[model samples]
Target chain A: MRGRARDGDEQRFLDITGEIGPELLRYFQRRIGSDAPDLVAEVMVTVWRKRALLPLEHEHARMWCFGIARNLLRNYSRGEQRRSELSRALRATVSVTDVELDSEEAVAIRDLIYQLGPDLAEVVTLTHWEGFSLAEIARLQGVPAATVRGRYRRARLALLAALSTDVAPTLL
Target chain B: MTQDKDHPAGTDRELGALLARGARPTTEATTEVRDQLAEMAAAIVSTNQARSRRRAGLISVIVAPILVLGVAGTAYAVTNIDWSQLWHNTPEWAEWAQDPDATVHYALPGGGTCELRLGEVVYSPDPNRPADVAADPRAEQAARDFLRTADLLTVADVDAMITAMRDKDENWAQADDGTAVPFGYGTDNYNADVEYNMAVKQAIQVAVTDHVESMGIPSTGLGFQSQEQCTGADQ
Candidate 1:
């Protein structure tokens, strides 16, 4: 019986990882840049430890994993002074500018998104980049859907204004 | 990049497209990440399986009989007594025991196991003290000291510590006598249990102080009760 339960847990973990692994990798890559793999491993370990609490529903499980990842990211940021040697090596080998952003426009847009502050930037990223609904983002973030919606709206306006300014100089 | 067909309404279509393009993963990178994920998942599964095996062995030896005794005790009480009297006679401490703040199980160095049931502001050590401790005074003091200083943050932490100890020695808590003690109490006998609990708690503190020169955690500060504290009037 215990073996069966263990098997079920392993299968569920693999299933979730298969579905959301790429997205999570991208998330960390975009946010923390080069240390994505180490953080991904940490998040996977947390997911395994808390596997019993994961919701049965697929979308809810995704959100729950993201919630864990968000907390892990917060802890990582807090104790960032103790970054691993591997992360530093990886950062040295691969520049975020070279690997992540394909074009100058995309790089500029990313910079603009970061300028909106972390909270608003996260809302914008989840909505546009990840294609999560405002309600789903709220669930993942432990916030109201209205709040996410408002932040996304504000982020869009900010991005549009920044883009317009960049284009204005060219037009003149 | 292909637009997300189910993109939410009111989002700027151009911005979403641009962000999606930026976020898109290369096939090679995605493959590498998936491989790494598979390896990590395997490691996690292996660790969990090892822990589960150790827990299963420990539970079969120690916990199974206690559970059976517990169930039998409840069953016998229910069948033998008038339901109303049983309900009426149940002390408030019984309810507190039902939802203890912490339950710690430890082994006696010589032989046998015991459980320390801690309430929010009280504690009850299982009546069945380890046989090894019963025979030797110094060993009993050492057991008491261990229990007093056992700092547990969560129930999971308690389980981990128990598992770790069990792994070191399978018969760490094996009792010489294989008899199970039934845990039940009527209203008249409830005070005796509370008194015994307080006495054991006090013994633990005294034992802890006598043994250690300088205590690190100050004997858990469990806010254990005195005889006066355990009363029907207080409840």
Candidate 2:
């Protein structure tokens, strides 16, 4: 597997890099914006060379890569420069998972949603919205299947309750 | 309550549909990003391949000089170099033979080697050490020292020193005393050969060390080969 990655062939580079590149760029776009195009480009280069390190399936690898990207972008956004850009090309591409809210009242339920802690937010993003299976989301977030269920239930209930109360009306 | 062929709970029916709708990717967006990805992927492959080719080409070109010098070195041994014939017939031949930087080709019994070298020693007249080798003990000593230090890079100690010289994070091209020390001494053919060898040795050592380290292991006992070899200027 590692040998193929080192082979410097054009087809192999594209086969792995071609599909995930867009999902990753959008992943970055929703998280940061603007200068993210360049950062995403840099990460893709790293991914091309390191793709052999990935698991067999594309979607799993895509989620795994986004996990790594989240870490890197967080590091990049910390200080050196304020990453601010609504550049047309990047703004044109948004991760609907990040932008779409359930209901207007659902949006204001951040207090309740976050009440389960950041872990709840992660589970929702990975499982409910990102469409990853319960097992995949639990594995990704490094939590057990049961805990993932408990949090998913609590989060949904919080959202529903917030909605009933006419909360911020945005938290899905 | 909820029920469907896919979901046992009806409550999740709305959630699943909404999540699917929310993250729906536009085909047009994926297409545009795919084109950009292909271009960048091609650029990376081109850059890496170009670098590998350049390195191989340089080593081949630089090694070509050794072939020429190896032949000339053998010819000088068997055939007499008549000064008169050399002066009139092949004037350029005299200059080349006399030039310290001439390409010297050597023929061993079965195998051959070559090297391109700088012109002969243009001596400075230090009154105490005249241009004539018989008069200049310092010049003679300098030549001797140059030969002594130019041992096989196979020497464990010498290889270690060369590694140290290269390991220094210095711009060897500059005069900075940062890490790599330049081997500077004289203008004799032997000195010229040794100095060039030192530089080549440093680069080779550095390359080997770097390549090895990149593989997550420390390197040991990997000796570098010199680009130059001795020819029969003695006889």
Candidate 3:
């Protein structure tokens, strides 16, 4: 939002986690709604541990990640539900947006963003599609504050051009 | 699409920032998750290393007696140790092989070699005599023990045994009853090879128990395979 912030050295996380994190977040969110944060934490821990399993290609990695998440979903369901308050306490630890994006739009945005090369695509998609704060993306991507901005600028312009419509300044 | 994350009032900027956030688990979470997975991987490696070390240790233990005896510098001193009594007291292969008739040899791949011939072959000759015996694990094992037994023999004796092993005859002769047999398995120059092969068999015999166990044989089943699937390749 602050005009394309640069997140430097996200190569490792970018190369691994990519956009899979949020998709996993959403997956855990829906399968076990309000308990989403704990599930998200659990899913991420899984991603990190099995990070080697992720494909080097970010797109393919995301798909493979979700496939794992789907399995985790089964695991979560079969599990005896933890105390509601305990999960509530865990969810409260993080300030995540409750706003749900339309899956169809999320997919469209993801596809548009994916069109960019890895770096620009990652920043653009994570910021716009996955809904991470620049601070968070900067942290995860391991980039200094400025690089994220440059990537975002190039990403926004490219995204705008790809969408081909200035009518809704943001979707691009 | 409906809410328009990109807004003229700088909505797309805010939208982009939100999209990039992924869940970063805490350190405890990271450790907890990776611990189990890494532990599983480590366990597999450790198990293999342990088995290898165990076999190595067994071999060292088996060879200890031989080295002790060799260093004692007197064959008679070795013969004097009521080996049967020692074997009964120790209740281990080392004592059992101390018998004058029992042959002991060190082999590679671990499980120090011990060939306890019950004075004679327990099972009848494979009918075809030694050739029909087909050099199974047992035969290979016996070959090793024979090496040690042959150790008690003079150079001339080893030469004779090596000829028999090769199925040829340098000093080939008929028994008093004129039983002219082809003997080429034992020769003096072949001692090194015999030593090496015996070491290999010792290792194979010890390390291959796992493979042999799964082969549906009790693994202790008498008689060696022509080519043991475990440590041996097609000979």
How large is the interface RMSD of each prediction?
10.4, 14.2, 20.1
Candidate 2 regions exceeding 4 Å error are: A8-10, A33-36, A56-60, A73-116, A170-172, B1-30, B47-235
Per-residue accuracy of model 3 over B149-213 as CA lDDT, tens digit each: 33221111222232233443332323344443322245322223323333333333332332222
lDDT of 1 by residue, A114-145 (tens): 78998888887877666677777778777887
Model 2 per-residue lDDT tens digits across residues A25-135: 655543344445555654554454344455456667666666555545544542232221212233344333234434433333334545556776656655544455656
Error in Å for residue A96 of model 1: 14
Q: Could you give the fnat of all candidates in order?
A: 0.21, 0.16, 0.05
DockQ order, best first, reads: 1, 2, 3
What TM-score does the predicted chain A of each candidate obtain versus native chain A? Answer: 0.75, 0.63, 0.40
Task: State the fnat of candidate 3 relative to the true structure.
Answer: 0.05
Worst window of 10 by summed lDDT in candidate 3 chain A: A1-10
> For model 1, which pairs clash?
B112-B174
Compose the digit string of candidate 2's lDDT tens values, residues B82-190.
Answer: 2121112221433434433223233322232234233332223324422221222233222222222321121112333333344452221212233322223321211
Report the CA-based lDDT of candidate 2 relative to the real structure: 0.41
| DockQ, all candidates in order | 0.16, 0.08, 0.04
Indicate the TM-score of model 3.
0.24
